[model samples]
Target: MPASRNKKNLQVQRSDHTTIWYTVSGPAEGPTLVLIHGWACNRGDFDAVTDHLPANYRVLAIDLAEHGESRSTRDVWTMEEFARDVAAVLEAESVDTAVVAGHSLGGAVAVEVGRLLPDNVSHVVALDSLTYLSLFPAQSQEQTAAMVHMFREDFAAGVRGLVEGGSPAGFDSALKNSYFEKMVAVRQPAGLRSIEGLVHWDMDAALRETKQPITVFAVRAFATQEAIDRYGDRFDIVLVDLGSHHFPVEAPEGTAKLLASVTTE
Candidate 1:
């Protein structure tokens, strides 16, 4: 089949005012893939990557509550609650089986989804996520407090720190600035609360519970040996030089190829 060309903007109501905005493309009966974006990012980040995916695959890229077009008034921002957002979409679509892929924070959510719907999710894919030794693993009480304090006290600085962390040496200043701007402008409360939720999450417990195969596509330059050494047995970490942490947007075709290789397997 030719590459998927038709895209539909859709949403599923989670509550009276809460709804998840998403896009659906490709065949309904095709192998399913659910794409979730990172913190402060919307489903739009995967627009190009979705365009590059094989036509035979069904793609659903979602905006988590309060991110992108999704709206909500609920205060909870835990990873498990975010997983429920993805689950609602899957249930709405009547998806029987799927390979769930997420970028950054979404990768954490993907792991939760695997645990949440073990019977439905066949595999879990993390894009430039789970490699950060400081962020992916569960943190000590003091560590979590320190991280959350940074964001609460100076949110922009915290967001800038994230942008800087993802960028490699000699990366374009303009591009880095663009990412920083977009991410720092994320909706308030949820932005800070989500970071708190992420820092407090127990990834070790989630990984232990999720029984599906897991793969991580990490930036070669930024990926650390320690992370690989630590998670080597748990995840199939493949490194690539695909421009910064936001490779899905920076190198859509390459990202698509990487995802295709995994989904096909």
Candidate 2:
């Protein structure tokens, strides 16, 4: 186990009628590293990663609205709104410049963060994210409906499919069950609606608007060749032999090293 570090829980009120919760660690004056958890995940996902990060790097792990400790009454669940949740935390922390790193859906939020605060966010990092061709690119109406229908009809099954899809062959069934249970129990309405929002997000437009050096640490087993070929010129996709889509939790030391590599560069 990694040594424990002191963390401060904080909240920021957003203009969009949401209160965002986040955790701050490391030195106060160190270079900022904003950590955004993926859909259905909370800031605790990065606790081990933070422990492995350099002592001089300031870390902010955020729980987006309606996830974890964060609460919101807003109805809009767009990727841009998720980015605003992050922006609220950055504003509260007074982060002048930082490398914004996110996992899964949070990866899209990181890109929007770069777009929202072009001057403050210097680099964007994605952990096993932004590789799904169906989700990232604009999907046809029928395609979007079909994807959303799965979650609407059987939420638990939809969550299970996500875990199974991300896991490699011979992966532990126990871990898969654990992931499925946790994700299936996500705060309702928001959990289902967020998936809808992700399906409709236009990654091509977001990429065009957000101009930042992006480094995607994609899992070798989950990432598709088509996704790599399409976004190859746009992003620095580094194929990692990590555990799975949730590799950040499974391999915190390796994840920290990947995030640190970009921060130091």
Candidate 3:
């Protein structure tokens, strides 16, 4: 009829200074699945997996502040800020008792959302994420300044370098291009550098709280058996060996099957 009203037709709103863009799919009367994308990525990351879910399950993916079709502000973007935006979207949608699915940076936000809405969030799924990232800081003040300067001048290049190189075991060429394109589209020059301002937060205790049932589908490179055992108390951690960090892009069937088990079972 009207192009079937794809996500392109969805609306967006500003909540407490952050802009959240979201789209809904599947049966209206079903448990909601709220998705959050990693840094520099958008809701479209979940396009493949959502379709494999049972028809009765509804899917929702949101753009974190400063990423995708959202707002970029002067303030730093903390995990807490990301969580607050998701909580606001939940309120706006009148959604209650949803399963949260997140990737990379989005995984951290999902943890915060679980903490924020303990009663309403039933479960969480973190894919190819970390409690601490693989990136490092410069050893000297001068180096730090250069890092910030480079980011300010060409934010896209800075992000590209991180994604296309030095990323131990996350993605290959095609998947890397897909992820990079999203980052280039969503990230702003000055604000992209704000990552330096965002403190390195440790969520071990927060994750261990295990407010509700949780699961993790991590990349083999980062999600070592040791790490899994350590975090297993909070989540039924599982690792996939086939794909790099961008497992969803290359191994959609496998990823979808894992999520479907938790969602349907």
Candidate 4:
């Protein structure tokens, strides 16, 4: 394993009255790589991945408001609002340009971030995200209602269902349980509201407005043909054999390589 470098933790306040927490590492002059963690996950998820990245790449791992060390009192937990949290961090760090990469829900937020700051964001990368039909493509009112109803009725069961749904066949039972426990324990109100926000998010509209090149590293097991057909022309969907939806955690070096591939191009 590559030796990890020193990381500087920082915080910035966004216009929406949310405090954003982030970590910075690597060379100051290196090309910036902004990492966004998945729903209910914090920036710490990328700690090992950052170590595997080239020392010349400036890395910024951010905690979306109400996730990780960041906190927010705002009622709106939409993807656009989450993107604003990222935008605020970039502004605070004075990052002129970057390759914004996100996992799961963070992937939707990355697209929003690119849309929100087209001038500053050169490329948008999605890791095991945006491939799930239920989570992307803007759900119908009836679909959204049913999904939200399930979560509202039994949040723990709903979260466990999500974990089970994402885990590949024959995956380690212990690992699956660990993931379930962490995700199920997400901070209240934000956790539930964020799911609601994702269900209601208009990904098609966002894609139409955002003009950045999107590279999706989708887990082969979960990459549906419908999603590929719908987004194939728009996004470069690369089917990967990495472990589960949380491949970055399981294969940080491979994930780092995928992320670095676009940054160098």
RMSD of 4: 0.9
The numbered model that scores best in TM-score is: 4
User: Candidate 4, residues 61-180: lDDT per residue as tens digits?
Assistant: 999989999999999999999999999899998999999999999999999999999899999999998878887879999999999999999999999898888899999889888888
Which is superior by TM-score, 1 or 3?
1
TM-score of 4: 0.98
lDDT of 4 at 121: 95
19-70: candidate 2 lDDT, tens digit per residue: 8999999887999999999888888889999999998899999999899999
Q: Say which candidate scores most in lDDT.
A: 1
Q: Rank the candidates by lDDT, best first.
A: 1, 4, 2, 3
* Local distance difference test values of all predictions, in order: 0.94, 0.91, 0.67, 0.93
After superposition, the stretches of candidate 3 with alpha carbons farther than 4 Å from their true spots are: 1-9, 131-158, 164-174, 189-194, 197-199, 208-210
Evaluate model 1: give its lDDT.
0.94
Against the hidden true structure, what lDDT does model 3 obtain? 0.67
Model 3 — TM-score against the truth? 0.79
Q: Compose the digit string of candidate 1's lDDT tens values, residues 1-265.
A: 2254699999999978579989999899999999999999999999889988998899999999999999889989999999999999999999999999999999999999999999999999999999998997999989989999999899999999999999999999999999999999899889999999999999999999999999999999978999999999999999999999999989999999999999999
> For model 4, which pairs clash?
none
In model 2, the runs with Cα more than 4 Å from the true position are none
Measured by C-alpha RMSD in angstroms, how accurate is candidate 1? 1.5
| lDDT tens per residue, model 3, 111-230 | 878988899898888887753333321124665567667777887787787576524553457667776776677555424643553324346655755487778787666655666565
TM-score of each: 0.98, 0.98, 0.79, 0.98
